[model samples]
Target: MATLRRYDLDWLRVIAILAVYLHHVGMPFNGDDFHIMNTDSSKLLDDMMVFFEQFRLPLLFLISGTGTIFAFSKRTWIQFTKERAVRLLVPLFFGVLIIVPPQTYFEHINEYASYFEVYKNADFGINHLWFIENLFWISLAVIPLILFLKSSKSNRLLCFFEQITAKKFGVFFGVLPLILILISSKKYFPSDSKDILNLSSTFYYGFFFVMGILFASAEGTWIHLKQFRKLNAVLFIISTIVFYAYYFMPSEWISPYLTINQRWNLWYIVCCLVGWTFVTTLLGYAQIWFNKKSVLVQKLNEAIYPFYILHQTVLIVLAYYIIQFELNIPLKMLLLLVTSFPIIILIYRFLVYPFKITRVLFGMKKRV
Candidate 1:
């Protein structure tokens, strides 16, 4: 179990969920212009949405890395696996079957597979649920890797990580992933669904995650930086600029493949480094500030897991119904978010609340 509580981790969870939500909800307006992703009725608004796009899931992945460290510390491997399975896999199964199928059915009408085929192949918008599915697999996949590292033979690699932590995190954890991301952008790794679904995405993300674990084990790599607040602030601004520049550039100019892979870019890589540092510093500040002030941030912290499991499904279901209402784009998204949030909340209260099995499977424990 966590010896000390961290509300910043909880806050990170909420923010990540919101990012995924807004990315799906607001991305249409962001002028991404990718045929499969475009839905925003406003060209200018879509362009502006690009400014915040880089910050979206990168922040989520950082939070996830933090959570991995937390989870690794708190449970036996079996317990951790069970907990992660419930949190990740169950939602994936339900989301693929009960939730995303209609959208797949609708979108692929020309090549429409049967509902059974779509369910089996997950040939739907369940594609967006990749984060949850991939993370579940990654959590399981890393168990053996962690076991090997815990063995005596991996001591040298472990010591190297420890030695690297002696320098600034911006040098070790921060710049390292960005360096890999930039290299990959130039040579480019495929970012297809199959890649994201298998070990590729996990290994890709695992490097960032291990950095987080090392940072966490060091336990205040960021807290020590408060003395350099002014320098950190300046770097934060520069990193933000780099992140957005890469996000907005046309796919053709950046990619030889001409697909919207959201593959790494120099600006993207630089910004992620700066962005992760800034966010980590802010998290450190939030941790210290909340400690001194005695603030509590647990309501939605408790609500968030279940909210994540059901929210996208609810949104898709709402969109399924709302699209029939003949609403405009803004009205459509509004109806989707509005309709989904409450209905999902109700499901948490009713359908998911009465049974212990349901609670464990969907993360819907009654608030204590």
Candidate 2:
């Protein structure tokens, strides 16, 4: 079978990364204790953040898994592993050593007079690059499995999955395994985002990564997704309403807090359902309508990885200053959004794109 080139996946990747940027910028405005904060905060922003938390990273991990299948198509398994290490780890190390300290400095500057102080006392932690750290390990963990899939012995198993993807509604099975993972994570690890070692998210994100692999490797998935697009959209809308209602509406009958020890809760179940539906609906729509290409899409796609690596640091620094102006929430968010993009773009274009060493450090391809 011929490998498909998915421009839609590229588009979604760009959108997801931008959404992360927006999410982080919204963090301080929403009263989350991020590296920086605007003086103005909003309950409305908090609600939006909760909704975004349900799906954003999951979508990216799924996309990463699909991209992995395509990437391996062009290289040997060992080659792929090395590439993932360089692509993921190099940027992670660079971010830890260079990019992240500014955020931490701003975060602790009143306590510590210098960036060097923050650097010395701080653990050289991955910070936002925790995503990269988790991804690197997850990629390594999946290699043996991918190697097994590559062998002729796995042909029958592959065929079995392919057959399922060919069925009209069978793609829904992808969400079932994820539910188990989410439940396990919620019960044990409980998703402390600040804890880089949180096994909960590792297992949770790894599930979506596997889902992407299945989607890419299975036959007829694209057709099935398109065929079920309308249903997926309806399900997405319904799930969104249910999620928001349960999440935002306060009533004596309903409690939003979920505990894994309880065996199951409506919040956990709805989150899994909504997460999968949002992904399905987005993927189906993108594949159907966004497969066509544009120059801007190509540029954004190339810029995305580096932008993700650099965006938060830039945002935190800019937000530190922007918040000092005492602007309302909308204008602060708008100003940060408008200002940060160009600065990030300029840095990527001038500093990252032109140099061979910087390219590798930032997870870009070496200059050809």
Candidate 3:
């Protein structure tokens, strides 16, 4: 068979990264503790962020997992490992050393006198680049599993997945494992701090990564997703509404019936449903609508990784200054979004994309 290119996945990855960029831009105004905060916060933005937060990172990881199948198709295990390291680690190191410190400096501008001082004393942490760090390690961790799934030895496991996907409700069955994992681990890992060292987060994201591999490994999985796209979409919408309703309801309303632990468990189950449904829904729709190749998609596919790496740093630096102006939250957000996006693109176009060293450092494939 000729190599299958998933243009839908390309589009989804680009879109997901852009959503993350938007999320970051809205961060300072979302009433959340961030590198910088607007003097006033937006309840609307906070609620919207909370809703999107349910599925955004999980969707990205799932897409990454699916893309891994394609990546592994052409290369041997060792070559695949080396490529992942270069693509993930090089930018991670560069971000930690060169890009991330400025955000930290701005966060502690009163305590720190200069950017150089912050860089010198910068703790060895990944910060927002934690996603890259997690992906690198998850890629390495799953190598053996991917190899086995590709080999004949894994027929039983693949067959089970095949059977599952063939059923009427099989696509939704993907959420069961995630639910079980979250429910079981909730006591130990209460919240995802987005730290690479957080085992809970690692496991949480790793589950989606592995799910992607399994979805790709079993033939007919995408067909099943497309077939049930409508149902998944409905579930996603319902779950999202239910999630926000439950999230915003007064605690006293629930305090009469459920204990705190029980309430949290219920919330986790809802979150799992919401996250998985949204992911499958998008996958299904992408298969139907976005599978066709496009020049724009190809260009974005090339540029998005570098864009992801460079985005948070640029946003934080800009927001650090933008939030200081005597402006309302909306105006500040508009300024940050409008200004930061083009700056990132220009930096990528003029500086990162044109040079081999910058491309490699930003995790783009070097030009031929």
Best by TM-score: 3
What would the TM-score be for candidate 2 when compared with the true structure?
0.93
Candidate 2 stretches greater than 4 Å from native: 194-196, 255-264
Sorted by lDDT (best first), the order is 3, 2, 1
C-alpha TM-scores of all predictions: 0.74, 0.93, 0.97
lDDT of 3 by residue, 1-368 (tens): 11588899899999999999999999999899988888889998898898888788998999899888888999999999999988889999999888888788778889877778875675545778989988988998999998998899989988888788878788887788888888787688777687766666778888988998888887778888888899999988888888988998999998999999999988888898898999998998998789997999999999999898889889989998998999988899999999999999999999999998998899988686
Q: Name the better of 2 and 3 by TM-score.
A: 3
- Rank ordering of all candidates by TM-score, starting from the highest: 3, 2, 1
Instruction: Report clashes for each candidate as comma-separated counts.
Output: 4, 0, 0
lDDT (0 to 1) per candidate: 0.60, 0.82, 0.87
lDDT of 1 by residue, 168-211 (tens): 54432556666565456445444433345344445545555655
RMSD of each: 5.1, 2.3, 1.4
**Candidate 2 local Cα displacement, residue 190, angstroms:** 1.8
Indicate which candidate wins on lDDT: 3
In angstroms, the error of model 2 at 265 is: 2.8
Would you list the clashing residue pairs of candidate 3? none
Error of 3 at 222 (Å): 0.3
